[model samples]
Target: MWLVLAFAVAGGLAQLVDGTLGMGFGVTSATVLLALGVAPATASAATHAAKLPTTLISGLSHWREGNIDVRILLRVALPGMVGGFLGAVVLTSISLEAAKGWMAGLLLFFGFVILLRFGFGFRLIPVPKNGERTRWLAPIGVLGGFVDATGGGGWGPVVTPSLMTVTRHEPRKVVGTVNAAEFAVAVSVSTGFVTGAAHQDIPWLPVLGLVLGGVCIAPIAARLAGRLPHAPMGTMVGGLVILVNLVTVVSLLGGLPGWLDAILIVAWLALVGRLAWRAWEKEKAGRLAVVGNPGVNA
Candidate 1:
């Protein structure tokens, strides 16, 4: 009962984050389950299973809220479905120990990417004035799906940021589109996990708890999507992903010295705080400018 409650809470929290930010449900839930000694295959399977209903509700809520782009959703979701299934098959074929390492590395990479993109506003390429050409979306979808299936959560983290960078769309639209597209990815990944040859027994209790908690919060989270400040939320989520995965990597590396761990965490927190403050200041300035010059198009 206690375990079920714990997962329920975790699921609610993860869904809140994912629905608002367009990512984190799988990453957060899988991280917790892995920490609790669940197998990689099982963890990924459970995460996707839980995500099915949650993503469905989230997508619909976003659609009702006018956050979706039908063209973007179809383009990204179809390729993502294929990639997700392939990724699940690949993950299931690998040995347990290797899969853990793979997940750790993938999570760490995505964490850093999130931090760079959101926290520091790093961009590798220039943004086009109108919008990015649609040709690039298919590849992005494939990559996002592959990573999400293999890492237990990445479609949003990968697809959302990538879209935001290339397109001129608002944050709410990008987040909504990613969250909506995730329903398809979840369906494909779940199917792959079930059909995989070395399928493990899923933790159905946790899945149920996650589903219930996530469903309850889906509408609220969708409503918050257009209202919340993206920078602070993105920075916080990136920091969390990095921190949690760091702990997993440390455990895999025969553990780190207690002092070193504390120092590392403190340093990371300081960086996250600095970035978040800068983002807040920038946003404040932008709002002030708009208020000062109501005639100008901000």
Candidate 2:
């Protein structure tokens, strides 16, 4: 009972972050589950399963907001589904111990990407002016789907940024299209896991907890999305993910010195805190400037 409640809370918190920032639910949830020693395949399966309802709801919201591009959605989603299914199958085929190290490493990589992107304000290549072909999106979708299924989450972090770099669409449209396509990826990944040999290992109870918690918080998250500061939230989530996966990676490498681990963690915390503070200050200053110059074009 206590365990289920704990999972519910985790799910709710993850959804809160993802809803506000438009990403992180799977990564955050997977980090927690993996830190608790869950198998990689099971964790991915559970996250994808839980995502079914949430992604559907998210897609609908974006559609209503006029954020989706139906053409982009179909193109990316079809390839994403194929890649997600294959990724799930490959992950399930691996032994748990081996899969753990790989998943941890992948999550760590993702954490760093997120940290660099939000904390350091790293920007992707500029989108060319209708010069890039949409066909290229297929490969991006394939990679994003594979990563998301194998690492427990990465579709938005991978697909959204990649699309923004090469496509001529508005940033909001790219975000919305990537999100809408995730529903298909989730379905395909879930199907793959259900049909996999290790399907029996899935933790249905925790999955139920995640689903219920995420569903309950979805509407609230949607409301908060426009209200919260994105950079701070993104940095916080990235830092947390990095810390969690760093421990896992260190353990897989036969453990780090306790003092070294402590030092690394402390340094990371300081850096993340500084970045988040700076982001908050920047946002506050921007708001103040906008208010002060009411007639100036923002």
lDDT accuracy of residue 19 in candidate 1: 87
Go through the candidates in order and give the clash count of each: 0, 0
Runs of candidate 1 with Cα error greater than 4 angstroms are: 197-199, 294-298
Worst 10 residues of 1 by lDDT: 122-131
Q: What are the models' TM-scores?
A: 0.92, 0.90
lDDT score of residue 101 within candidate 2 = 89
How far residue 108's Cα lies from its native spot in candidate 2, in Å, is 0.7
Per-residue accuracy of model 2 over 120-146 as CA lDDT, tens digit each: 777564556666667788998899899
Residue-by-residue lDDT tens digits, candidate 1, 156-183: 7788877877777788888899999999
In model 2, residue pairs whose N, Cα or C atoms come closer than 3 Å (at least 3 residues apart or on different chains), thus clashing, are: none
Count backbone clashes in candidate 2. Answer: 0
Give the runs in model 2 whose Cα sits over 4 Å from its true position. Answer: 124-126, 129-133, 168-171, 287-298
Model 1 clashing residue pairs (backbone): none
Residue 54, candidate 2: alpha-carbon lDDT: 80
